[model samples]
Target chain A: MQENRSIPVMDVLIAVLLIAAGVASAMSARHLGKSVLEPIGPGAFPLAGSFLLIALSLLVIWRAVRVGTTKSNVDEFKPRPGMAVLALALTCAYFLVMQLEWLSFRWATVGYVTLLTAALFDWQPRKLPAAIVSGLIMGLGLTYAFTQVLYVDLPS
Target chain B: MEFLLPAIANVFTPMPFLMMLLGTTIGIVVGAIPGLSGGMVIALTLPLTFFMESTHALILMVSMYVGSTSGGLISATLMRMPGTPAALMTILDGFPMAKRGQPGRALGFGIMASFAGGMVSWLFLALLSPPLAEIAVRFGPYEIFSMTLVALMLISAVSAGSMIKGLLSGFLGILVSMVGVDPSSGALRLTFGVPDLETGFRLLPVILGMLVMSQVIGDIVNINQPIERVQTSFRSMFMSMNDLRRQWTNILRSSLIGTWIGILPGIGGTTAAIASYTTARNFSKTPEKFGTGTEDGIVAAETANNAAVNGALVPLITLGIPGSVIDVLLLGALIIHNLTPGPLLFQDSPEVAYGIIAGALVANVFMFIFMILGTPIIARLMYVSRAYLIPPIIVFCVIGAFAQGNRLFDVWIMLAFGVLGFLMMKAKIPTGPFVIGYILAPIAETQLRSGLMVYDSSFLPLLTRPVSAAFLVIAVLTLFWPFLMKRRKAPTAPAHLEDE
Candidate 1:
C-alpha cells in the first residue's frame, strides 16, 4: 500500500509557519530598540538566525516538492499522548509548586515526585508504595546532598 | 619525559585510583542499561565534578566514559538489544553466536577487540593531541565557523536515505534556534502572547520530548504487541583461550578502524563500527559465517565502537571544541568548575589533562573486568518491565530539569523538547546534529562577531586571512564531498540493490 502525500506537505507547511513566526518576532524586536543595539545587542544573534531560518525554510519547501510520495506515512504515526501527559503533569506541578515559599521547593518535590511515580507504575499496585517511598527518600536525599553537601543554592 | 613524570604523580594517587574504579562501575551499569548512553552518563557527572579535586574528578569522568562505551556490548551480545546506539551493529553476529551456543566465544572476541581499540586510540590521543592543539591555536573565527559547517554536514552523513529531508529537519531546528532572544541584539524572535516561549526552546525538554516521550507514545500505542523474554545464564559467559587466539586479527583490524574514526570530530562510534563491520565482512575468507554466528563480526563492531569513545575526546581536550552534544555538556560541566577544555588544558594543568588519558586506559581495563562479572547483574535488570521503570524515569526527568535551575521554565522546556524530539525522530529527522547545532551556535556567533570586530567593520579579513581561508575551504569541501561520493556510487547502488 502507498503512503499519503500530505505528510511532506504538512512538514513544509510547519516549516513555513515557523519561518513566519520567527520573522514576525524579529520585526516586533525592531520596534523595541528602534535600531539594533551595537556589539551584542537585543537583536543581533536572533535577527541573523531569523534570516538563516527563512532561507532554510524555503529550502525545506523546495525539497518537499522533490521528495513527493516515496512511501513514508508520516501522518499514520501518532505522538505518544499517554506518557507525554504523565510527563507534562509532573512538570506543571513542579513549576506551580515553585511559587509557594511555604511549600518549599525541597518539600514540594517530595509530594510531586511521589505522586507522579505512583501513577506511572500501575504495573504492580504493591510496588506503587515502594515507588512512592523511594521517591521521598531520593527527594530528601538530593535536597540535603545538593544544598548542604554541595553548597548549591535551592529555592527556599 | 616531562609529561611522563607529572602523569605518574597525578594518576596513581590512591583517591584517583579509587574514583576511577567507582566511575567505571557506574559507567558500566549506566551504559549497560538499554535507555542510557555513555554521553548522558558523562553529562550528569559533569556538573558534579566542579566541586571535586581536578585530578580525582577527571579520573572518574574519563573512566566512566570508557567504561560506558565498553558496557554496551553486554546487552548487544546477550539479548540482541543494544544498550547503546553504537552497539547496534554488534548484535548482527553477537546475538546469532549466542543463539548458536557460543555466547562465551562471542564475548571474548568483543572484549579483546574493545581493549585493543581503546588502547590504540589512547596512544593516538597521547601522541597526536599536542600537535593538533598547536594547529588549533592558530585557528580563528573563520576556522571555527568552517568547523561548525563541517560538523553540520555530518547530518548529511547520518541521514540514511535522503539528505534533503535530513537537512530540512536540521534547518527547521536552526529556525527554531531563531525563536529565542537574539544573542547579538537581544530581540525576541517567536514568543507570541505566551511569555514562556520567549527564551526559546531549552534543549533538555526538546531532547526529552524526542527521546523519552516520543518513544513512550509509540510503546503505549503498540502495547498490544507481546514481547517475550529470552533467559540465559552466567555460566555461559566464559570463553576458551583458543577462541580468543583465532579472532585476534579481526580484533586488531577493527581496533585500528575504530581509533581512526574516533579521531575525527562529528563522526561517532556507530559510523565507525558499521564501517569496520562492512570492511571485515568484505575482507573475510568466509563471509557466509558472518551473520550465522561469526566471532569476527562481534570483534569488528565492539572494538571500533569502544575505541571511538576515546577518539571523540581528541577535539574536546585539545581544541576547546566538543564533538557532540554530550561533549558540549561536558564543556559546560568543566566551565562550572572554572576549567576550560582545550589545548591550554594540557599546559595549565598537566595532571588533570594526563589523568583523563590515564583514566581512559584504566577505565577500559576495569570495563573488561566488570563486564565479565557484571553481565549477569545487568541481564537481570532487563527482566524488570518498562512499566515498572517508566514512572521513576518520569520523576527523574522532572527533578533533573528543576534541579539544574529552580525555574519551572526549564521543566516546561524539557517536556516541550521531549515531544518535538519524539516527532522529529518518527519523521526520520536526525536529532543528533540538531542538538550539536543548537549547542555550537553560540560559539560560532561569538567567534565570528569577535573576528569581525577586529577587522574594522569589514568581513573581508575572514577570507583574506590565510588560516581562516583554509578552514573555509575545508568547510566547503566537507559540504560537497557527499554529493561527489554519491555520484561515484550511483551505478554501484543499483547493481548492489539487485544482488540484495
Candidate 2:
C-alpha cells in the first residue's frame, strides 16, 4: 500500500495569515512617510520587515507543498479541541462580565474559577465540590493579596 | 570594584535577603512541578514587583532564576518527567538510577553537580561582565545595530522547526512591535483606528499572555494525564568525598561548556545540558554505561544546566542582550523598573548590576541547601492536580495585565495574544525568537536609523566598520551553519530540546 502524505494545513494557514499581515503592514508603512533627519524613516524598518515576512511566508508555503506533512509532525498529546474551545469561551465570558462591570472582581473571579476548574475536571460529579471550594479560596485569596498586600487597583 | 561593597550591602540587607529566600523557595517548588516553567512563574510575578524597590525586585527575580534552573532534578529523577526543559537530559540517567534502588544517590549527585556548576559560572559572571561592558560601551550605532541583527538571526537559525517558520515568527513580532505611534514622528501607524492601540501592546500584557496563558491552556488540555512517581528516601542524598573526587573533572568540564553556551545569545540551559551530556558520553571510558544509570550523565547534565543560568546573565548585564528566553524576561524586568540595561547600567546603576551578581551567589547557596533538605517535600508538589493550578494562574495573568496600566483594554490584549501564542504553539513555531524579535526591534531600528544619519544615508559603513562587519559576517554564518552541518552529516542535538 502507498503511504499517505498530505500538505501541512496548519503551516499553509499560518503562511496565508502572515502574507495578509505583511501586505497590510506595507500599506500602512507607505502612508507613514519618511523622516527628515535620517535617510531611513519611521516606516523603513516595518516596510523592510514586511517584505521579508512575505517572502519567507511564501517559502514556507512552498516547503509545505514540496515536503508534505508526516505523522511525526503532529503533537504527541491528543488535542481535545472541544475542551479547548469551551475553556476559551468561558474565559471570554468571564472577561466580558468583568468588562461590563456586571460584578466585582472577587465574585467574577470566583465564578470564572469555579466554572473553569469544574470544566477542566470534565464536570465529574465528585469533583464539583472540590472545584467550587478551590474557586472560593483562589478568588478571595488573590483579591486580598493583590489589593491589600500588593496594592494593585483591581476593578472593584 | 568601588560598587562591589555597596552591591553586597544591598543584597545582604534584611529585605532583599528575605526576598531572595522566598524567591528561591518558590522557584524550586514551581520548577519541580511538571508542565509548569520558570518563565511562566516569573512572568506572573512581574506585576507584584511594581511596588518593590528596583534592587529588591532584581534580587528576587535573579534568585528565582538560579533556583528554577536547579529545581527540575527532583521530578526528573523521581517521576521521569523533566519539570523544566533544562532537566530533559537528567531524566535519562536519573530515572534509571532511581529504578535501580539508588534514588537518593542520583539526586545527591545532581545537587552537588548543580552547586559546582553554579559556583563556577558565578566566578565568570563576576569577573567577566565588567570588562565585557567596558568593551560594549564603546560600540557605535552601526555596531549596536549589527549586534542586534546577529542576535535575531542566531535565535531564528537555532530555534526548532524550519528556519523559515522561525524567521516568520520573528518578523511577525517585529510587526507587532511597530503597532503604536512612530517614535520619531508624531503620527500613529498600525493602530487601525483603535484608541487603545495608541500605546501599542505593552510588554507586560504580551509577555504574560504568551508565556503564562498559553501554557495554562495547554495544561488544561493535558490535565487528565496520570503521574506515577518513584518513591525514595533521603538517607543517601549526601555525596561522599570519593564520589566528588572521581567526578570533579566531569563537573568542571561540563560547567565550562555550559557557561560558554550560556554567553552565546539565544541559547538556553537545555542546549547546555544536551551538549554537555553528549560530550560526557563521548569522553567516557565506558560509554555504554551512560543511559542505564551512570552518575556521569546526571552530573554533566545538572552541572551544565545550572551553570548556564549564570552564564546567561553575563550578556544581559553587560550588553543589554538577552541570552535565552528567561533572560528576555529579566531584560523586561529591568526595563520595567526604569533602569536601562547595557554597559551604561554599570555606570548609572552600579548597585543594581552588582546586586544581581551578589544575588546569584547567594541564591545558589540557598538552592543547594533547599534541595538537600526539601527534595522529598518538593517532589510531592509535582503531584498537585492541574485543575487547581491552572485557574489561579489565569487569575494572576488577568491581574498582571490589568495592573500594568489599570485598563481593561490591556486585559483584552493579553487574551488576544494568548490565543495567538496558543496557535503559534500548535503550529510548532518557536516562541523564543518571536519574543527576542519583539524586544530587539526597537533597538535595531533606532540604532540603524542613527547610523544612517551619521553616515550620510550610506549603508556602506555597515560593512566598512570592522566590528559591524564582523557581526554581520557571523550572523550570515550562523544562519547557514545548520545547512553546512547537515551536509556534513554531523551529529546534532535533538530538535525538541532546541525550543527551550
Best by DockQ, which number? 2
For model 2, the superposed segments whose C-alpha errors exceed 4 Å read: A1-4, A72-78, B484-500
Fnat (0 to 1) per candidate: 0.29, 0.64
- What digit string (tens of lDDT, one per residue) describes model 1 on residues B1-500? 46745675566678887888888887777776666666656655644565678778778877887777777887787776677778878888887777777666676667767887888788877777778877776666666666656666555655555565566555555556556665665556556656777777755555454445555554544433333334465464554678668766777788778877776655678868877887888788997676777878888888899888788778778876665555555555555556756766777776666777777777787788877777778767655555445544554555555555556666667666666665555556566656656656666666666666666556787788786677677667756656876786565332322232
Backbone Cα, N, C clashes tallied per candidate: 24, 0
- Candidate 1 chain A: worst-modelled 10 consecutive residues by lDDT: A34-43
What does candidate 2 score on TM?
0.95
- Which portions of model 1 miss their true places by more than 4 Å? A1-17, A28-45, A58-80, A100-107, A154-156, B53-58, B158-162, B168-228, B235-241, B481-500
Note the residue pairs that clash in candidate 2. none
lDDT of 2 by residue, A1-156 (tens): 235688978889888988998998899888887788887788887888899999989998898899987655445456577887898898898889998989889999999999998988888889999999988998898889887888898854
DockQ in order: 0.32, 0.63
> What lDDT does candidate 1 reach at residue B122?
80
Candidate 2 per-residue lDDT, tens place, B1-500, comes to 67776787777789999989998998999888988888988888889999998889988998888888888998999988888899999998899999898899999999999999999999999999999988988989999888878777756544665777788888888888888987766668788788999998899899888878878777766765667678687778988999999999999999999999888776679879988998898789998888788999999999999999999999899988788888888888998999978887888888889999999989999999999999988877778888888888888899999998899889888988888887777778777777888888888888888898889988999999999999899778767765764665345544433442
